[model samples]
Structures are given as structure tokens and as C-alpha cells.
Target: MRCQPERGHLVYIWTKNNQFCALCDEPSGVERDLCGPCEDELPWLHDQCSICALPLLVDGMACGECLQRPPAFTRVETPWRYDFPLDALVTRFKHQGKWPLGRLLADGLARHLLHAYGEGLPRPDCLLPVPLAKRRLRQRGFNQATLLARWLGAQLQLPVDEQLLRRTLETPPQQDLDAATRQRNLRKAFALSHQVELRGRHVALVDDVLTTGATTQSLARLLRKAGAARVDVYCLARTAKPGD
Candidate 1:
């Protein structure tokens, strides 16, 4: 699928400069160069599920899954749902080799991070992207999570440390797995880099989408072990109605 038609407006809002659409370089809507519908429809992460960051409820406690077993990240935020045109946006970036979408995704994520974490969240000194395996990176020609981290870091004015985390294990895709299987696959998949000292410093982990959150959980657990005082996740989109 192509990138969503409204994606240009979202980018305009985040960049806040009069930038021609990257895909077409055509002039966008007037003023901020955004049409009314696109601007209105830009979904911000609002009163939502506390655990999965979905959009069904607010003022409620954690979801059942988090109660049974919570994720390792201190908190999470996502501006859009992993459905509809947003899903298409992800595919365009990852599989279709449309790298510009990373900047668009990062813009949404930065706003949500500030909204959800607010003052309660620690200001991270560095951004640690959930690393990808060598083979996967070679096939994709890029790590989408790392791309998001870089762009998010620029927007948030945080440092993006590409070497803060390392991948010790590589497993098959988690898309076909259940929650338990997903967790098992990612276990020990992430290893903190001794080359950098993360201890006592807050770190933000970034990724494209959080499915079961197993990968993020595993990475966060490791970051905490490696002297990171606090860990948070910044993802572009999260699944809606997580139970499915």
C-alpha cells in the first residue's frame, strides 16, 4: 500500500516549516500548508489504555496482561493505531523502501512522548533504538527503529546513541507467534553495549510499532540492568483494542 494521503499534513505539522511534500515536492495547504481535514484528523495519543497505549479507555488501570506481567519499559506512548492507513504507512517505509516515512513517524511519536510522560518522565540523555539483527538489517538495507530514533532525537533535542545497545541473538519474525512465543523469541535477543556507560542516565528506546511489546520489554530490561536509571519507549503506532 502507498503512504496514506494525509501523511504530508502530519509531516508539515511536526516540521512546522513550510516544506513541500517530500513525495511530490508540491505545495501543500495554505498557512501551515495543511488542509483542514488532514489537520483535524491527525490523531494524537489521548485518554487511552494505560498498558498497551490503545485508545478505548481512560482513567482505568493497567490492562489484564500488564497486571499479570508488566512490560519492562517505565512507560510507553504512541500517537496512532496500528490499523488503517497508518499500517500502510509502516509498510511503505519498511518493505517498500520509503525511508522518508521515518521522519513522519518520529514527529507523531515525539508529541505523544511529551504528552504521556510529561513531567513525570525522565529526560533521556540518549536514545537507544531496539536493534535489528545483521541479516535483517542487510535485507532491509536499514533499521527502521534506528531511523525513528534518529529523527525523534532530532525533534526532541535528545542524543541518539546508536551503539548503546547490541543484539546478541536473532530470531524469526514474531508476527506469527502468540504472546508467550513472542516473549520467548526476544529473550536475550538484546545486549547492552559495554562500549558506552548508560548507568544513571535516562534512556529512550524507539521502535516502529509495539505489537506484544516483547522486544521492547526485553530491551528495557537490559537497559535497566546496564546502569540506565530509567527507560522509556517511543513508538510510532500501537495496536488498538489490544486483546484482538
Candidate 2:
């Protein structure tokens, strides 16, 4: 396969002083190789619901809703709770097509997850980026989630397989809808496509952020239906549910 450059993945980074990292605005500090402000503003999920990944009280298990009706995915791992510098960075990457920002965030997530799950989290056989609808892909030029997933997969030593699952609907962006409405909108939005590769394999589904989780859940539902043994989600950030 040959690599083809496109509009979506043409992201660069800006230094702390706004010198010249075009697509991204990353700070430069000695520690952790991140800007000082960037280091502090990064939200770590110290305690959270095990299943849904919402920050929660100590020793929290699964959120009530998840317990009542479990999500299609077994677990989610995200270091930052969608906020602050992360929010700005993520938004810039998604809407502005800053692909470098996506890569930086994905690297941070891969590191955090390796520690959080220890050896408990099984290494996925391959990575499946939550696909974008064809129209969106045409408009955006690149799938931000795909950009992050590819970089993250390389960092984690996992193969990236973009063809395993797909989005069927040009569903309204989840950020535009309420929780219930978001879930409703995403219903049946994904379908399984690759059979020979996905059957009985474990998959790590990647996305830029996990909001209402409708998108990730939808993908997981389809992958599992296609014979995947397990599905785990890895997003750069996760929004802590209301009242969490």
C-alpha cells in the first residue's frame, strides 16, 4: 500500500511562543517533554466508572446506566476528561484539521493507558478507527480519528485496519444533541464490512474523543456482531458525564 497525503492529515504544531508548528500548538518544557501549562491542564482520570470511563467517586464500578444496560464495549481508556487545553487542542484538531495535534494526543493516551490497565488490558490484535461517513470524509479531507488511530497503533505496536467497520449514516454530530438524542441518532449508524480479518479478533477502536459514547458504542456493536472476541475503546479524551 502506498501512502497518499490529503487535506485532513496535513497538521503541524506551533511552539509555545507560536513560532512554527503549524497544525498544533504544543508547549516546550523540559519535563515530560511537554509545555508547562500543557502538563498541568492535562486531566488525568484518577478515579472513574470502570466501564464508561467517567471520573467518579473512589472505587467506582460501572455507572448506573451502564449497569442497567451495559454498553457494547467492555471498557474505555482515556487520560484526559474533555476540558481545558485538551478541549481547545481537540477541537482545533477535529474542526481545523490539525493532524499533528491528533497525533500528540494519541501518544499521550497510549502512555496513560499502558499504566492504567497494566497487563490486565489485553493488547488488541489490530486498530479500527471509528470511520467517518463518505460525505464527511470528502469535506474534511482526512478523518481526524483515523489520523490519531494510525499514530497510536504504531506507538502501541498494533496494526491499524481501517476496513474492519464503517459508518453508514451521516449522523448529526454528537456534540449537537442531547444524550438521548445522540444515542437515537447513532442507532444503526455503523455496519460490519470485513469478515475474514475481524472474525474472532480483538479490536481497539480509536476516536478523537468520547462524548456521549454513542459513536464508539455503535462501532463496537457492529464489530462484536462480526465475530470480534472483544472491543475496547481508546479516545484521547472522555467527557465526564453530567453529575459525575
Candidate 3:
């Protein structure tokens, strides 16, 4: 079942050159809706697993799980850790349909990806959003992943293939399941639409957040088996290990 939006949800609209900070509501002093200080205070992921982007104590190290079982995706790029005001912001956007907040975060993610590309990160040929189940899509009235992908595509000048991949199963909410159960729940949950040829092309999966990673892992494995040259994940934030 879906959760209700928090009482602290903020309502704002996007502007081209001027906007108020979504967090503090002060003049952002930038193109985006987040002020410099609030952006700095965000739970930025510094040192993390190179592949999964799981937060870590040191840099350039893989988490124990990834070392044992590597994910099919090449790497994950995210801007913040799932905590505090970020959690609230994401909840508002996803649950309450506050698209402007989603836009704010998507813009931040686009900037992050731009910096990464500047630092030699390989850009994918297209962006694919992690599809939501039909039932859930109706309930929520939108797919956050699709919105992020479109926004990022516009910002980065990449094509977004919304029909390239799809969710074929309606599983329980992943947040309610354990890691192992999450993986099990996703079995055969996704399949390629084959509307576009992905052969030899690199693609990035867009989503609002990555938790146990089972969803992306499942989708990545499918893409790899279908002859995709590479797969990557781009999201607004990565959650710490359960109970961390």
C-alpha cells in the first residue's frame, strides 16, 4: 500500500533563472531551486561502492556484498544519501505529486551527471526509467522514474526510451521486503519491450531512489542478456545499509 505524504511538503514551481530554495525557501541565487547552503547540507555520498554507490567509510572500495556478487549494471551515479530533508523532499514529490520538488532534485542530479561526464564518466546512449507496475502507476498517477528520465534527457541532450523496458509483474512494495525477498519478488518482474534495438548501445536506468538495489540489478541483468553494451543507474539518492 502507498504511504501518505508528509505534512511538511512544500509546493513550488520551476522557473528558468530565478527560484526560491525548496528546503529553506530563501532566494536560491542560482538556476535551481536549492540554495548553496542547503545543497551543501544535503547528504552527499562521498566514499561508496564504485558499482552500487552504497555509502562507505572510505573511498575506492567495494561493499562486501558487491565484492561477492557483482551487479549487472556498470555503475551507479547519485547525488545524495537517503536521509533527513532529502527523504522528506522525495516523499513529497513521489507521494504527494509535488513535481516541482522532483524537478529540483532532477536538476541537481543532472548537474551531478554533468560533472561526472566532465571527469571522464562515460555517457550512455539513452536513458531508461525503471518502470512501475500498472496498478501502482494508476494509484500514484505518475511514474517518478519516467519524469526524472525525461527531465534529465532534456538537460543532458540524451534520448529517453520510455518503451524500451517495462514492468511485467506487480510485486509488493520493495521497501516492505527484506533484501533477499526484494530480489525474489523481482524475478520475471521486468522484461524488454524490444521497441528499440539496444544492441551495442549503453543505457542508463533512471529512478528516484535506490534501496536494496534488487530492482536495478534485475533490470540490468535483463539488459545485459539482451546484448546491451553497458547499463548504468542514475538516481537522486542512495540509502545506507538497512539499520545503518
Candidate 4:
């Protein structure tokens, strides 16, 4: 059985100069800002769909939607569920421009990927961060995915190519739409750079969160058509279905 973070875990607070927990302001005593106890209480993703990584009753099985129509990507790898403190942290990083909070989350993701690699997950040839629409980028002042990809690249010793994909159309937020509408909204929404050669290359798309996964599906379709041998998604969090 999959385990979930026990809510209401006590948070410890302390003052230190070296490192402090992002959640409790306690001394981390490690390179990362998150301490052990707080890390243990994180909303880790457990039983999930093998393809899209959606929360599921059983592990290593495809969800109904994925079985009916498979996504362009092979698999999704995310460490957390978009719940509790994670959602708030992501908001601070993505909306409020808290780079440190984003960095902490990215660091945790890097460690997760490394463990996955150790467990035989194939390392991708390159990393491509999902691009943001020009208007959204202007409004946000930065792309969280780009920062995540860069940080992951540095930690994993992989190459990050931010120029490979471009968001051509500014679509409404996927959160506001249902699954079907989300797919339609992403149609012709992304364009790939023709200059780069991707034939037979294994690439992973980096992003902050995977909600409906419509965005990654659209991007993966484009990459597969462009001759990428394999496509995977690397995101910090995966959201569950409503009331799941």
C-alpha cells in the first residue's frame, strides 16, 4: 500500500546561519534548505499511473484516460503531489518570484531523479524546459521551468536546451479547463526550432507541475514528430483528480 504524509506533523523551528528549513525555519544542517523531519512530512506521490503519474489506486498501472489514448511521452517522474505546503511553495516561486523556494524544490527534484536513475531510469540525452508564452513570461518576469531545468542540469551534469521549444499561442490556463478542452486549447500552441537535430535523441521536459498534462502531451507530440527517440516528463509535483 502507498503511504501518504500524515497531516499535522509537528514543525520544529530554530535559528541558524548556515541553512534553514523552508517550512519551519529550523536549522537544516544540510546543503538543502529542507530538514529531515519536514522532508519526511512532504506530500510525496505514491501509488500512481505509470504513464502520466496521476494518483491511482494501484502502482505501475496506466490510468483509464492514458489507456484509452496514450500520451506522446513515455512516462512522467514527479516526487510530490500538488497538496498542502507544496502548492503554497510553488505559488510563491511561480507567482511571487521566490527564487530560493523554487531552488529548494528543484534541488529535491534533482535528488529524486538521481535515485530514479540509480534504479535504472534511462538518463535523457538532453533537458528541454517547457517554454512559457511571451506575455506570461513578461508578466512573471521568469519561467519557473527554465530555472528548474537549469538547476537540474547543473546537479545532474546534463545539457539543458531552452531554445528547442517555443510557445506560439497564448492559451488560457489549463487549470480553468477540463481535460478535453485543455487538449484542444493546446493545439498548434507550440513550435519547435528547426535548426536543432533531435533524431534518435532521448529528451526530458522539465516543468514545475503536471496538472492535466495537456501541455506536456502537446509538447511531447511535437518532439516525437521531430524524431526524438524517447520523451519523458520531469516535474516537481503532480496534481490529483478533484476529490481523489
Question: Local distance difference test, per candidate?
Answer: 0.74, 0.77, 0.92, 0.92
Candidate 3: residue 215 Cα off by (Å) = 0.3
Model 4 pairs whose backbones collide: none
**Candidate 2: what lDDT?**
0.77
lDDT tens digits, residues 126-180, model 3? Answer: 9999999999999999999999999999999999989878899899887878889
Candidate 1 vs 3: which has more lDDT: 3
Q: lDDT tens digits, residues 1-244, model 1?
A: 8675575466444565554543344665543333445534555556666766756666446776777877677777677777765676688888888876666667667776776557465677888888889999999899998888888888788888888688888799887687789888887788767656766887878888887778888888887777778787778887755464
Q: Quote the lDDT for 234 in model 3.
A: 100
Give the winner by TM-score: 1 or 2.
2
lDDT of 2 by residue, 1-244 (tens): 7476576674553343333332234535342345655566577667888888877776457778798889989888888888776788788788888666676677788887677658577788888898898998999899887888788877788899887677777887667677789879888888877556567788888888888888887778877877888899988888876665
The 10 consecutive residues of candidate 1 with the worst lDDT sum are: 30-39
Question: Candidate 3: lDDT of 127?
Answer: 95
Tens digits of per-residue lDDT, candidate 4, 1-244, equal 6365456653443342479888899888887788999899889999999999999989999999999998999999999999998898899999999999999999889999999999999999999999999999999999999999999999999999998899989998777788789999999999986567889999999999998988999999999999999999999999999888
State in Å the error of residue 41, model 1.
3.4
Window of ten residues with lowest summed lDDT in model 3 = 8-17
